[model samples]
Target: MFSQSVRSFTKQALQWSRIKLVHQRITLTKFTTLFFYLALFNCIILIALQTVAFVDNEDATEIITGFLNQANVTQDHIIYISNNELLKCKDLPSLSDANCETWLQEDDGDDDNDSNDSKSRRSLGGFFSARSVSVPRHHSENAKTEKYSNGTISGLELDNGKVLDTSCIQSLIWLNDVIHDSMAEDVVTLVFQIWLFFLSLATILNESLPHLGAAIAGHVLVTAWAGYRIRNTHKLREHYQELIVHQVCEGVDFLGAWWDVRTDHTIPILVFNVIAFVLATYLATRLYRVYARETFNRVRASPRLHKIYKLVLVLSVCVQLSGFFTVAATAMWLDKASTGSINRVAKHLVLYRAVFSTMAVLEIPWAILGWICIRSENRRQFWIFAGISVLLLASSSAIFASPLYQFIFQTWPFFASMTIVSYLLILVITVLGVWSRTQFGKGLPEFLKEEEKLEGADFAPVYIPDLKDRKSFDSEKGHGSDIDTEPIASLPPLLASQPLHKPPPAEKRYRTSSVYSDINRDTVKLSSTPPLAQAILSEQSPVSDCPPTPNRSNFETASRSPLSRTPGDRSERSRNSLPGNPRPINIQESSSGRPGRTGLIRI
Candidate 1:
């Protein structure tokens, strides 16, 4: 009864073990499907939000252009003011004479007429028609001469004896440029998001750890970019508000109204950014979990080089991520410094942009090559990767020593810090990559391939014949014993019940070349022998039925018993007993009517 219960328990355990593997496979499939759908939804929503942002940017540009036109502000006027340092009425020498009051009165009348005309035109024109107004050309050369001499200057004196400051005009121009840049950034981001969406789909289809890692890197980049844009927008708004509070201008009310409209449009984008960031973070975490689990499995398969391989992968990801952020920050810094008061040569800026952009763009391909090299243990690819790393390191170092280094530190300290961090990370990756190159081709790739095959086999479907069909088939094959009729799940327990004193039939024995072949063959042999052999061998020997298991043993036994002789030995003995030159023996028919040969087979 106890043995029967053990058999039942073992059968149930085998069934449950198979069920567990199926359940895990099903769960993973469901998870990947859900992730793919969620990512698609995210991509759709981002597209809508970016579309709205693009429209808002267009509207803001039109509004700014309309306001500039109504104020009669031309690019030439702005350039003239900037070049002459004409900031206020006190800075204008033409506004300090007794005729200034008369000029102010005339200017006020002319401004009233211009305002009336602008209002009529605006009323007649459509929404974007504000930009359609042809700006009157300004005589910057004449203005320059009038500023130094005593020539009368037009539009210098305003109502209340105040002159328009360049600060307000500069702020408006800056804001317009910011909006345009935001629009461009939106387009770029939209493209990147689309690329990421497809990458995610590929990741789901292939379930590749490296692909998942790349997706996570993309998510991090998008999230950081969104945050940076948000911060920059907030700074722009604050600067505009500060200008309105400190300076008195005729367009202040218009600016406030336009700003309110712009803010309303911006709020939706902010909400979208928040949602995108949340989704990105969630997806990144999920992908990271998957990546880490797969990486763990691969590492476990090849533990000899696991430490170095894992470190290389980790450093490669870090390098890619840092490289992306560094490029972004450097671009932002370039934009800010190029528009700032600092005097930088154009050639230097172009060089800086080119170098950083190239490095950033190469990061992805470099990481891919590194992964391939590591997996395939390709020495040539590793050398190429190492050489590129050295070049990038040297180039980065050269950039640090360039003239713009101080400019970056002073103008954009964040960029400077990111550069430093990225440089250090690159250095580490280079060193670790070279070290890992030496440890390649040591059976790690083969181990990983074996692991993949095992996983695939676990998920593969198995067909089990019905019990009645199996029994019929066994009977037809002349193997219809009770052992052959048992279900597969119960066969292991029944085989385990065989007595240990009996050895397996020599015809069924075979050798294996695997490292663990001895253990595996011994286990299979012990479980496959007939139970009756135990009783017969024990009764003849007068020893216990079960013997202690040995660590290692050969299947071939030389006990001189008929059952113990191998097939080859038996055949050779028959040939020798056939009335030959060296040896001969007699064969006779037994009572069972079967010809029997009696002889000892010697090895």
Candidate 2:
């Protein structure tokens, strides 16, 4: 009685433990699901904010242009100043004819008449002296302006009747170029953000480790980029403010105001970026923990296969990272090369951008395909991915060898370095992809499939047929009652005359059926048994030849031998069978419709 009570308590304890484990699993899953969606919501908000910021930056060009027009500045005036190198007029012979020293002498002579007028005149004189250029009166139509680099400039006039010098015109030109470049960068950043949003969505929905890693890496890269842009913009603002302080250009104040507005717009974006980065980091950490648990389980299940899976997973993540960098590098190159003043020998800028962008986007699909091929061991996908990788490799090489390389390098050395890094990463990814393909049929795929099955087992439903009306059900099907049914074949006379044997222990009877039925049957076929026992086994009809047992439940029928005739025993036994009685001989039918022994009947 004490043993029985102890056993009952132990069973209840085990049941409670199982329940607690299940509850923990469910709670963890719910927690992760909630946080995943929260992160996605944050991403959606970021996308909307970024889109607004992009549109605002894009419209800044028109705003700057309108401001320049209001200030009586034309595109031609800025271009003429840039092309003519008018800012260094002191070095020009034509501008040297008007003596800047005469204006300074005149301003100094009037210092006592009116101090305010003298200060303004002195400032004007000092501006000219700083550039070492003459104060120009209106240029007569007959005046010959020296040709500088590309265009010949006569003079620039502001609405205030003040002749604009090179410093003022150059500031306006710089402002226009900065706005244009900012617009281009906005476009690039917008596109990348869109890509990142979809990548994040996929990672959340698929719960894939590789996609999670890629999304995390993307967030970090974009955050760093945002910080860089903010810092650079601040520096440009300071530089323009210095120009305003020195009163170098008449329009420097307008440019400074525009910079202030641009900075205000960018501050919000940076705030959103930092918030998104934090969310991404949190989500990635949780995902990695879950991934580690699953990985640990897989390793315990199959170490060799897990090793291969680990390698493939690492390589797949690297491929994904490479693809992302490739896109980023291409975008940077496009941004720089497109905004450059220098003309490229390869005039198909649009075509080049399209081709490189397409190739960069294709890297993502290639990485996904490589992962699929490795997991599924699909040779067709393997070959397709390999072929695409090779083509991309060739295209990348051609790009390096093309004139675009020099254009990009000349435009921005940073872009050139990023491109080189992207190329090397791609090379590494391609090599790893080919290597991963070789790991096909190495049991990793099967192991993963089995793991999925085991994880899903808790949700699988069980069906138990009703057995209360079994006799009527069997009768309606034109089958005799199972209880009244006679044996289809009689035992051999020699074995029938032998004494009945005591049944095997209850524990042996309760053991679950082995999956290796064929191996058991083969063992029965080769075993040496007494002639009488063998005769009795041979005389019993095959399981398929007998009518179905309607009285027994499906679970009981599956657990016990079909030949058991008594309620007290679940398997038939022969007395004096080999020493130390083993399991009863199960006379089941083979797939070939022959009677076969599946259990050993040792004495």
Candidate 3:
């Protein structure tokens, strides 16, 4: 009784353990699918946030001014530029001739270059400096309002008698210049982060779940924080937009000036995010479905291909790292070595280098994972990167050699396009994963042999199909045929004497095959008809060893059913047969070709 009770307890424990294992597996599968979806969702949110964070002119202006101030542009310079009236002077040369730059020009040399420099400096100074002068008190409300209590006018009155602060116009232009510069940096930063996000997804596709999942989770968390910041930034931008619209609708005093300088940084961000969100959502849905179905299990990549993939990835990482350092060192050198155009070029070089470097660093992990997940379509992304790298390297080298490299290179547009292209490329790559072939081709690595040996017993039961039982079943169903068991009497004497080809060696046969080999063979059927012609024709020599020729009539007679042809039809056979200089004829037929087995021809 005690033994029976213990047995019952053991069986129940075994059943519970099996149930727990199945539940754990199902839970793991769900989590895997969930993480993939989360990764994609994070990317989408980040994109949206990036669009909002960087797409406000007001905020951009603030950042630019702050950056310029940090770069050592003085408060006086900012104030002068902010209120400059250079735009009112249509003819710059005339403006310079009329305005003597009393404060800015040194008047030290008589050289033409010195004179030109003086004129340019004076014109710029004049635009920012208003000709303030002491004025007598006026009774008129407007005149009184314009004059300070100290009896001084604050601004220059134009020929049209309009007082305007042109200094502010200069400030606006300066802000616009810096805004453009900072915008590039913003784009680079966002694009770099985006590159990292997709790269994490790529890793998830290729790496072991536990390791990759932890890495991806950490990355997504960082991205999520960035997204949070972006969302807040969006709110600020929206509030600013509201303020701008409110001021415009109210026809504020500076409405005309503000409208003239209005920058629509909003549209591009909106458009980019809208499109990106849609694409990301679709791709995420597909990715979710892929993981849910455990479709990645079907993908079988060769060990040699994996090695090649890793090598390519390593090469890419090396190239990216090299490019980053090269561009960075060059930019820093140029910044110290020269100014003006060179300075601008150096600034752009540094920004783009930083972007590329950040992306490269993030790409290393993904490239490592690519060994497992790299598909034919993803190959194009790498090829495109290589092409872009070559083009940029050549262009950068050429630009560096040129005297006016900065002015000629126009790095912003080019680098911006490249960043956009990178984003689009990754997006396409992510989407293509859904269509990518997942079935692993047959092959076992050397290490797998040891594993197979250890687990061989466990696998035997699955592969040990009952061939005898299958044959019996086939016979009972009347599907079994004598095609594979046919006698050699039906074959020609020459063909029958030829030995069958030996099968391939075991090692060579199993080199790239699965552990459980499923052998299959093609079945061919042969039906004999009555003899169409005699061995020798009537017209042939009696002792001739050559066989008789089969004419058109013999072919027709052969086409008929075996039952249709009579064994005693000697007259028909004689008529069909022809005197021959023929050797033995061998017939080969395939089901895919000519009907009724008319493949016979004399050699």
Candidate 4:
């Protein structure tokens, strides 16, 4: 709710700001797509980390359950723990088999000893083990004493009074005291720590490092492509003609343009789904970039920090992965030694849940970075996105840290369900790059944006080639005469009246408006009309001047009369009325039309 409220307030502020926004480049290459892929990949990683976390929680749960059932802690004393009920006999009220030694054998070596101990069987639960018991002395060299119990001949006990006729203990315990310490999670933690250290290095080498290289190369490649695309973007959309303007008393609330991804009725759902999902995801992240930039700038991070950050990030991942694998190894070890009968159902739940819950804890940091990276365009969108991010992270955390998550897998006899979620999450996240590619660490646009935004206030241009009278430069030159007419095409052609060779250097220099304004004025808005049009508008009254291209002079002569028209492009204005190509403008009407200007201008 707090997040949502933030979103609402932020949205209002952003919406207002957007209205005031003058212009922004609408090109795609300025964006680093690696960040988008990273966002996707980060989610995938979270899913994976969540799985490992679940497994770890299982380990914790098993250990906790074991402790609950344990009779002792130190190796000095034996603690017999089981997953299920290990001993049961309803017939004998005072009898119990908590201890495991000295059960009666079928044939007693000494008949006299059997006679003395015969009453003991009736009092005890049939063939019972006395943990602190005396075994009948046997002459046979073959028989061995049971280690867990006292001097007893181990034998199965059958409860005769019950209809089931069952031997009570029904659980499995594989490793005894001899190997429990060796196979425990703490030991596994160390081993997996080693395993994960290497595994993460491998991940870094194969997945991260390669991807980073690909992205670096991709940056150069994409930038080149964008430059190429812009050089020849003459093909305007065909639908631009359909831009029927509507007059609104209050102006428009929203401007939306829709494109049909699938115009045909028979597009395959699989292909459509793929395309739509990708496009939507891209648009969302692109919109997100604006917001993400603000945060990256706030953090004051940079790609230059990648080397150290990568080392640290990899190390953190190594620690986390080690913790994860340790949980898995411990669970597998416990499952083998589990005794279902001795331990209650509640105990199994506890044992498995605790171990796996720990796995979720380690993924929290990655999730945070992801949230920080999945930006929205403005405060409003950012707030909303933040809320969603929080929800995704919290859900994963719940699955990782909560008991409900353990129950999800514990109910299954095998870990098939849990494993699926685990595998999918890992695969998707690694590929997706943690909800945002840039969020993972470095070499990304998120880093780039920060680099751009956080430059020192004491910035100095490389060189200040002092110029003269920019406002005068602006006033004197018409469209053909202005040096900045084709800014992207480089400096405008040499002035017509200026000498072809160097005539002489000027003595004085002056700054136009301010040094900064003149130097960095790419984003400033000029008048909507072209300089040539401005010349026509001021030089000639609204009564004259249409263009004359090729043989369309007669048709345009009538069109230029401004009989009932407004000041719009002649070509655009002629669009709706004419049958053939719209008549070209007739340039013969004005006082200093092309004849007079071209006559005077010569470099």
lDDT of 2 by residue, 77-186 (tens): 21212211222221111232322121111123343668745544555556434433222222222222332376644334534454545445444554565556566566
Sorted by TM-score, highest first, which candidate order results?
Answer: 2, 1, 3, 4
TM-score (C-alpha) between model 2 and the true structure: 0.54
Output the worst ten-in-a-row residue range by lDDT, candidate 2. 98-107
| C-alpha local distance difference test of each model | 0.51, 0.55, 0.37, 0.31
lDDT of 1 at 111: 42
Best candidate per lDDT, number? 2
Question: Candidate 4, residues 115-168: lDDT per residue as tens digits?
Answer: 534543332333223212332211112222222366332322212211110111
Clashing pairs in 2: 578-603, 579-603, 580-603, 581-603
Deviation in angstroms for 516 in model 2?
25
Q: Write the per-residue lDDT of candidate 1 for residues 1-603, one digit (tens) a residue.
A: 999999999999999987775454334544565567666877887778777777877777776665454444544211111111212221112222312111111112244558644543443343234323332322122221112255333232232344445444444554555565566566656766776677677666555555566666676556665666666665555444433322333424223344444555556655655665566557556555544555464335546567755665676555545445445545655564455222222236667767767776776667567667766778888888787788778877787566455544533434554566567767877887877777776776776676567557636322233465555433332344455443454657877677445545655443223223334544311122345544443333221112222232322221222232222345544543343212221111133455333222121
Q: Global CA lDDT of candidate 2, please?
A: 0.55
Better of 1 and 3 by lDDT: 1
lDDT at 181, model 1: 57
TM-score of each: 0.52, 0.54, 0.28, 0.22
